[model samples]
Target chain A: MRHSDQDLRTLMRAAQGGDRAAYRAALAALADWLGGYFARRIAPAQVDDLVQETLLSVHRKRSSYDPDRPFFPWVAAIARYRWIDALRARARRPETSLEAEPPVASPEEPVLARLSLDQLIGHLPAPQARAITLTKVEGRSVAETARLTGQSESAVKVNVHRGLRKLAALVESE
Target chain B: MTERLDMMIDDLAAELAPQPAVRERDGRRAALAAALVTIALVIGLLGLRPQLVNGVADALVLVTTALFALLALAAGLSAIRMAQPAVGAPRGGALWLFVAMLLFPAIALVEHLVGRPADAQAQIGLMCLLNGVGASLFTAAVIVRHLRRGAPVLPEAAGLCTGLAAGAVGAVAITLECGGSSFAHLAFFHVGIVAAWALIGRLVLARLVRW
Candidate 1:
């Protein structure tokens, strides 16, 4: 999930130079990368087949890799080309792809969430800011914030709207 | 999926054969050599047209042959580059060659209307067209086979380049052997190689270069 470009390139170079261990490691890293790549677009069962196909393709075209250029684009191009071929073949025999279940994002790459609510909310006018921070950032319901802050439910909604607009403008201008 | 891919990689690693240390530029050199040999064989077997000796003295004949020679070089280089996708897209040299070949005749036709020596006669001969087609198919098949072993990503572009490479050779053959100076004859007989291949390259390579 966190392989660096230099590390991958070194592994590939060693692999190209006939180091079996390096080759195995490179393939391992690539398989991990491709799992996340395909999982986002395809069913779980389909990911393995595409990964296998892409690995085989990359191995075949290893000689074409230019040492001067970055490796990921060349590798990704082969994967995309192989995927198109698979799509074309599957289209001709439609029964193969139908058996797979629902698609899902890759479990290997956990999605991270980061919100800077305090900074954004601080940019709003004081009353509107308080309403937004209490409802959105502090996880309070509008009715709860209205009762706590002595504002009507409709007034809380209007303040929250104004707060969101200011936050969006500040973020956009930056 | 991870387990299956790991097993697949192990199989691949176990069977991994050492690839030849060929540089990207080497493909271009190899393709050009192949093209030259094909052109040579075609010329030797078919024999140059008897008019070539006298025809070379003519300005249009020199111009036409020179144009096709450039086409041949461009198409050959493009085909080789296309074999290695990382190098970039195949050059548009073949397309330019085609446009020039088509444009030259129209210019000649206009000149004929103006009483200049356009020599725009129409000679319909299936023999040269058939010969050009045969040579083009043969040359293209061989080069494409070699390129396919390299696992070209853009089979269609590679196929078009293959056709152009073969067409370049066929164009040379037609230019060397055809005695006709007619605009229609040269367009239909000589330049037809590029046109035919450009049309069929996509369909043919889809099957031939399948992943």
Candidate 2:
């Protein structure tokens, strides 16, 4: 979040030119950002997997990015396609539910999820993180968090439980 | 999680596949060039039918030839556009053909309404239509194979456009090669090929283009 969009663009362009460290940093930032982005829209349990796929999709589609254009949209385009693909895939097999939780990263995904609080906060699903950030981290009431996030109070409460459960699962896995 | 994400980033970088830059090739140019070359060869080999001039008045022959040529060109451009992963439907570009399409059917209907009973003449050798389709298919197949690499996001649209391009070539060849100018024959065989290609694009070829 400290880097300007211009800085991100420069980082991506360097990555395109085969700067490995720059590329890694850009992807790390993107993966972290995607965690926040997806947290709001989907269940907390689904966030990590989406982040990994979006990272790969961005890597695969890097060819399509025009450096002159804004960076996020290019990344967002890949994210959108992957999201749609995931939706179609989920639709084909709707028996899966959030409560069941997902298995850890698949072979196709890079193993991710060592979390420092900043990076952990970075990696949490958007809604869960937002719910946590508002109601727990910032000490807002559940109703105020719900009002800010446009979530029902029950949904807000559920997100807090689920977000905490996600952290606990990471600890249990560790 | 910090160390894991750090290691993952490093590993991802090490394994990262840097994609080659995308250069938007002119699919339209490739398709049209292929079509024009193939149609030229078809005409040279099979010869334009002598009956074409006598079957229709000079103005109508000129008009019909122009119409078929334009249709072929339009379809060629569309096929190329649709083949690109980024470009999807032909959108507004495909509407022009409907004018020619409607005119053919409307003329046939009005002729029948005016008491000229459907004048379907003797079935001439439709050998050229088939050959034209085959030849254009070969050319289109070669060019489209590369276009497919660009990633056909709308596989159905891409396939339809590719098929329509080939069909246009076939239609043009038939225009010059068929002896019968009967409204029924031109409508059924000439224009019908494009429709067939569209269906093939939607049903058959789309699957082949997918990643």
Candidate 3:
């Protein structure tokens, strides 16, 4: 069964109290979320290591985690930082390949895509940006994202529905 | 292709988690080393010569012990409070404690110098000077730990260095008053204590503080 935000909060408290079971459960749940988040940006072979690094960092800094905040966002922030660190490490490595695909979409694409999406997604609300990131960027199923995110499946579905419609409308207008 | 995007997201997720084994192994090693050091120091202190123990000629030891015990209790409480999620700026409190611990020994030295009776007081003063030197070394260890953790090192280091200098001066004063011409003992022991404290501080700081 999916745990609610309140449920995750309880688990966080238990983990802070040094409950191994609660820590394990929390790690297991966050791992999937983090896995999907990193899988998009790093090589398949490196993703596992990155996920492990993020999880370990989270565990080490667990005492710093505020129970009042939703767990997934905090986990997501950690994942984001790990992603940035990985990118920096990769940048420092000597480039051996004769040809390498540019690390990301052309800078122009980000500017255009973000700007186009911002007008639309920005208008929908914060929930829509979060929902789209989970569904589109992270590729979590609506039910799973809802469970991890502590939103009701119906609430998640609505956010996804509105987000996608807004994106489609923005693209159509352009 | 959409499949590529799916694969990429999956790959990134797996890359972010740290290896559980590495974390566990490092934590275990650190905890074990700290415990071992504590045990070794306690054993070594207990093995000191009877003369050295007997030479502590006044009630100063009792007073110093009481003072340190209270300080240690306060430090322990601060550590616990800093560990809480709600505590903002843990570094601030940690820094303050470091400074206080460093200055504590110097304060004791001043109190000993200013208050003790002139004749027997010289012996007491000498003992207090030695004790202050020991405490200064301990405080240096605490400061080094803070530095290793990537915390600000300047203020704590300043406090410790100042205390060490004050302790050396106190030792010299006691030696002069006691009609002891041996600057060697004062210089060697006082400076040696500071160096030892710095070394131990580096080791403990490296072990405990997360970089």
Candidate 4:
């Protein structure tokens, strides 16, 4: 659902003046907008958490919003601030890094492959990179690659096929 | 998740009461008033410099006092605006004013190194430092209170501006009462107080303002 800036502003103005219905509508509209906003910037799994946090911030800092101003810009600023905070917090977390995933291929795989191999693999998600490296690059049997990467043999084949397709797409675009 | 969000919205709406929108001008006005009151109290306790009363305060004294007043006004307004954050809000000219205010300390350091006859009065200097810091407390409280009432995106920047603004207020309050004309005194006691407050704002006030 989309809300016009004017509609949001009017609702916000009334909300500031203690109109409960207007306040609820305004917040609901804001929550929807915040969902879309964060979905564009972060992973799907993280979007809901950021949306909730931004809404909480809006509720606490409602007084900071001026009735004369456009409501979206003010709300957008709060969302951006929360997004930055989330990004900083995520950066500080060591367990979330791509390197934390299972190392299926040998450490010397990068040296033997083309210089762009690591950079291309870096573009893929961790699972895709691990699957493609083990089954395709290392020429390991599908059953062995699955066992090493802790995936089912079928899942391993799917990831390698998807990863190669994405690599091809990336190379063509470049 | 949708159900959770709906519940949250209901809860927030239920708790809603009439809330006045935070105005940047109001925060600035409150901080300015607090600074003015502190200045008056400090001046009342320790009378104006003799030269100022005689209408013959030197060029350096007049200039330094004026700089402090300007810095207080600039940084004070900037701090208030930061509390009411907006996307792409242009940071005001407080940064330039702060840079301008540093000239005094640079001059003081040069003078000290050149070995000019020391105009040292350990007791008076220490008293001015304490009084300068004391005068800033109220102004900083007013600004920080305003910050708590709103949402500041860059809390560290807000805190630094708060310190600069409050320190400048203290410097303005004590400048009229101080008779010290030496660069070292102005640098150490006046500008030093502002620097100390800015550091405190960055380290201490950031945590207070963080959401």
Candidate 5:
């Protein structure tokens, strides 16, 4: 259900007051938003980790939140910062050279080709699609994704690796 | 053109906007403040003797202590409620209440300052100044904590109120001990202190609390 701004504010205030349930609800609401956000840039596997880390940070520093303002902006700002930090960390590590390139669609390409890929991605199971998006697009570490998705780190790594192979096979057959 | 494609991408990106995260840490801070106030009140009350008890002192100490404890309880309750589900969470009124609580100490300071003999007044003034500095330190800590967590100014009103409550309680305690109860002393001391606290609270809220 769509939560009103007032509802969210009340929830936030409660969360600030040390309500675990309120915090979870707030986290759930934020997860959806963050999921879509990570889907665009990072692989699906990494979104869960980013969300978890962001939530932990939010929890650790919750006392600084102001009750008067909208809660989402504060969350978004945190997420943005977290994303930047992750990017910076990746840049510093330089271990993973296998980055997913954004799809390069030329003007001359048929609309059907783009449509087919979108449809194919959509057709994948939600978990698989999410794993692929986080790992390939968002470029989050497997451990981070596992932590966010509530799966073991090994599971996340395997899922991303498997999901990518399946997607590549699908594209080749198509 | 590529511009149109970029615009579409931008629109899609905007559509997938991420919501901000919320953390519940105010309750902990409030609890800490409450605990501190309770401890302070206990110490202040324990220090009181019949000889130290004046009319103004009695009134100030009793009122400030009780009010501070009440505010502490309220803060604690808010913190408890914050731990619940979003649907079950309490309102933001508690924050405003906390802000109101911060005003009490300023009132006490003014009351104490108004009635003392000039020689005694200087000592009280110095003590008040010292207390003010301590309170400022606490306020600074609260402000920094708020900023780091990305909390807005409105929620931190509790911290402001906590300060006020502490100030009011101390002022009242001092006033009672000093034997000043006249309307002029009460007005200049209690009311004036409250007003000053209000002003300071407003200034802090505006400058530091606003995200």
Candidate 6:
């Protein structure tokens, strides 16, 4: 069942006072909300992990909460911050697979991932985007990517590194 | 997934202990205390200016000192509030104060353009600049240390505020101690110190505060 903002706030306020039962209940409810929040922003396979990370952040920063303020925005801000962190991590990691891995992969699976990647790359300059797509996303060797893109191998490597760094910075700014 | 979360929640709940909620005032008080401590240290090491001690400091110098003190109060409190990460938190007051603080540099620039440069005291100005930056280090450490205890969503902005507040603390101390009252001196050394810290806070402190 969905808990109202007031219910969560009341529970959280009690949790701050060392009520373990209230703390557990509030956390459970927040977990559900966080799941929904992450599910909307990230791949389904990654949503659970993001939710867990955000819940940990909530636990760590619980004391930062001001009881007099509305609770939803505070938690929401934390959730958003965690989401940015997830994006930064994704931007930094080497590409693993073009196709979606199964079990948790939706039918729309890797399409969402590709679309999001395209959206991020779309923000880059044309040469940087092409170089990154050919080298990183397509997993081509630097020499092969250079041959295909008509750029030097060093240029391709530079573009890939710079592109990824820019992507990490973009995620950071978000 | 459900079981893992349930277990995690159990662990967190089990570890939970009673603690006071972090108040906005706590950060403000800490920043104030850090600024005071730095001021005291500067007094001990460099000694307060004779003009200030003799009550002969001109109105412009006194006004400049007041501005630095006010900026430190506003930006220091705002930086602390940023750590708490509330939506719609009041930060504009500090921003406006920072903008006002830029007037010193602007005035200096205009004066230079008009060929009205003040007598340059390169040696004293250099010393004041170094002292101002040195003074900022302690206060910046205090605020950033407090920030490390909490998650700041806008880490870059929080870092900027931290630098400004800390730099202002340094400016306040050095201003009270340094004898120079020239706009060029105030702009280059006093406000310049704040600018330097603001950059460090934006670049370094942001990385440190990011969770």
- DockQ leader: 6
Q: For each candidate in the order shown, give its overall lDDT on alpha carbons.
A: 0.66, 0.61, 0.45, 0.80, 0.48, 0.82
Tens-digit lDDT track of model 4 for B125-211: 888888888889899999999999999987877898898899899998888888887766877778877877888888988788888
| Residue A167, model 4: Cα distance from true site in angstroms | 27
Alpha-carbon error at B24 in model 1, in Å? Answer: 3.4
| Cα error, candidate 2, residue A36 (Å) | 5.7
List, in order, the clash count of every candidate structure: 0, 9, 29, 0, 60, 0
lDDT of 3 by residue, A50-119 (tens): 8777767676566445576566655565565565556445423312121242344345433453454456
TM-score of chain A, predicted model 6, versus the true chain A, to 2 decimals? 0.69
lDDT of 1 by residue, A77-108 (tens): 67767655554443243222232344334554
Query: Per-candidate TM vs. native?
Result: 0.69, 0.63, 0.34, 0.78, 0.35, 0.81
Give the per-prediction TM-score of chain B. 0.79, 0.74, 0.34, 0.92, 0.44, 0.91
Model 5, C-alpha of A128: deviation from truth (Å): 52
Fnat, model 3, is 0.05
Judge candidate 6 at residue B33 and give its lDDT. Answer: 90
Which ten residues in a row are the worst by lDDT in model 2 chain B?
B83-92
Q: Which is better, 2 or 6, measured by TM-score? A: 6
**All models, RMSD in angstroms:** 13.3, 11.9, 17.3, 10.6, 18.5, 3.8
- In candidate 6, how many Å is residue A126 off? 5.7
Error of 2 at B13 (Å): 3.7
DockQ of each: 0.18, 0.14, 0.05, 0.36, 0.04, 0.48
RMSD of 3: 17.3
DockQ of 6: 0.48
- Strongest candidate by lDDT: 6
Please tell me which model should have the higher lDDT, number 1 or number 6.
6
* Lowest lDDT 10-residue stretch of candidate 3 chain A: A90-99
Q: Can you tell me which runs of candidate 4 are displaced by over 4 Å?
A: A97-174, B116-123
Evaluate residue B60 in candidate 1 and report its C-alpha lDDT on the 0 to 100 scale. Answer: 59
Worst 10 residues of 2 chain A by lDDT: A107-116
Q: Could you tell me the lDDT of residue B97 within candidate 2? A: 75
Rank the models by TM-score, top first. 6, 4, 1, 2, 5, 3
